[model samples]
Target: MLNIKNLYASVQGNQILKGVSLAVNAGEVHAIMGPNGSGKSTLSRVVTGHPQYTVDGGVLEYDIGGQMTNIIGKEPDERAREGIFLAFQYPVEIPGVPASEFLRASYNAVGRHHGLEEMDPIDFDVFVREKMKVLEMDDKYLDRALNVDFSGGEKKRNEILQMAVLNPRLALLDETDSGLDIDSMKIVAHGVNTLRSKRNAMIVITHYQRLLNFIKPDFVHILYQGKIIKSGGPDLALKVEDKGYDWLIK
Candidate 1:
């Protein structure tokens, strides 16, 4: 489970997240929905230790393997190594590094954190290929530079590929459905739905209920002005889609 308390975070002197709090239990999928500039993305970055956003107040804690750790104080890499995974809204590109090499390095480093030995090169190749296949990615993608020239949907699929490989305790997805067409979205959603289990939890951050239509969440949360304004089951998403965000502002 994860616990966040009264989190006040800022970026470049502007307070983005003011008094945000939420909890996600294991095996539960919680969807965070909000209009742009509502600090939905900021909440994910602050929890995962993005340095650009300073945590001015409150605690971001994670209970991993039954140990409570305050992740706000940890570095981004350190937090990643500690079973917290963020499937970025926009995955960055590194032109020189091949996708396979980047994943191997990341997977090995994270594996070490769990006291697992690194995978041999051959083992890694097979492992990555299988996961990529689940994402419907071709083998040729492994040879390409990480996210280099990848389409928006491709980038999103690649993000889930990391989540599949890392198998972290907590997965934070920020607007993962953006730019993905329905077919591509289904592939990504199926990958996520298949991965849900008691040992892991997911927070799907999105603007619409379309993605939720594919992977049903245990709870739905509406975020407005950096705080959780309302929560309900799937019906909340239906109401939002029927009424749109216009009603919420009023």
Candidate 2:
């Protein structure tokens, strides 16, 4: 449902992504594994239209309503409205914004953009409660400040909770496994897998195979120096876990 062709992106003055390209089909999960500085995060951020990232060349075409449109010229919020979601590795804590309040506003905004009816406070609360149940997240979390004073795992779970609620066409999970303990990792992964379907796609950018074990991807891509250097099935994850990316260093 999404395709990026010869995409080049840079930050400040340094170019990170160099002619990267990939295609993601609905109902398929893709894993992008790479060493640091290979532009993995850069790719995700650029695809999401982060203001800090500048597209130097190439086209980022997104399929919406069966029509392909170039998205390199769109803003981050515009990209989100077009059905792209990016779950941050480190969720920023808005000190005073309550989680429930933020979520309701976000959900309502997306609904309004799609010309759908916006949920009132009560309806939105009920909707969020249902999603929280699916994610197995505690209702008490809704009373707390958004990510403020939350544990690393709690922050990550909260992100997944947002994903389950919004149901984006494509979700870009950037290092969702970082800083998570075994139990937390599995919980988060389960949440992601449960939300996957014939109409949604996921691009999981990770550094470890443990996350892949839980949410097995249809394609595993090894990104080196801003390009996809290798692709295979699940066995590549096993090999990387065994080999430690040493051979891919060159």
Candidate 3:
């Protein structure tokens, strides 16, 4: 559903992603593993049309209604409306906005884009509660300011909750496993796995393989020096876990 070709990107005039390429089809889960500074997070930002990162060269395309269209110049909201979702490594806190209010606004915006009717607060509460169930979240989360004082695990689960509500066709999870304990990671992974379907795809970016153990990627890739240098099956992650990136880098 997504295809990238030799993408070259830079942030603040310093190049980060150099000649990186990958293709992800519908229903597939791909895990990207690399050490720090390997451009793992940069790839996700570039794909999501982050304003700070400029794409200097190559093509970035996505299947918009079954046709691969170049999305380099598209605005971030435009890309989001096209079913691209990014789960940030560090979810920002919105001090005054209730989480439910924020979620409903986003859900309604995406729904309106697809010619669907918006739900009233009462109706949306019912709708979002079901999604919250998938993440095992309580109703209290709805009243809190978005991530205002949430713990690391709570923030991560909230991100998955957003993903469930938006139901994006292409989900880019940037370091979802970061700052999460094993139990918390498992819970977050359960929420992610529940959302997996034939009509959607996920690109999981991380520095370790433990996250893969729960998410169970269909493919594993080693990203190094801003390029995907190795690709293999699930065993590739096992190898990385056993030997680390040093072996792959060498």
Candidate achieving the largest TM-score:
3
TM-score of each: 0.97, 0.97, 0.98
TM-score of 3: 0.98
Q: 32-112 in candidate 1: lDDT tens per residue?
A: 998888899999999898879999998788996688778777888887887789999989989999999999999999988
By lDDT rank, best first, the candidates go 3, 2, 1
Tens digit of per-residue lDDT, candidate 3, span 68-152: 9999989998899889999999999999999988999999998899999998999989988988887878779999999999998
- Residue 111 CA error for candidate 3 (Å)? 0.7
The 10-residue segment of model 3 with minimum total lDDT is 130-139
Candidate 1 lDDT at 45 equals: 93
Pick by TM-score: 1 or 3, better one: 3
lDDT of each: 0.89, 0.90, 0.93
Model 2: per-residue Cα lDDT at residue 210 = 94
User: Which pairs of residues clash in candidate 1, taking residues 3 or more apart in a chain or in different chains?
Assistant: none
> After superposing candidate 3, which stretches have Cα over 4 Å from the reference?
none
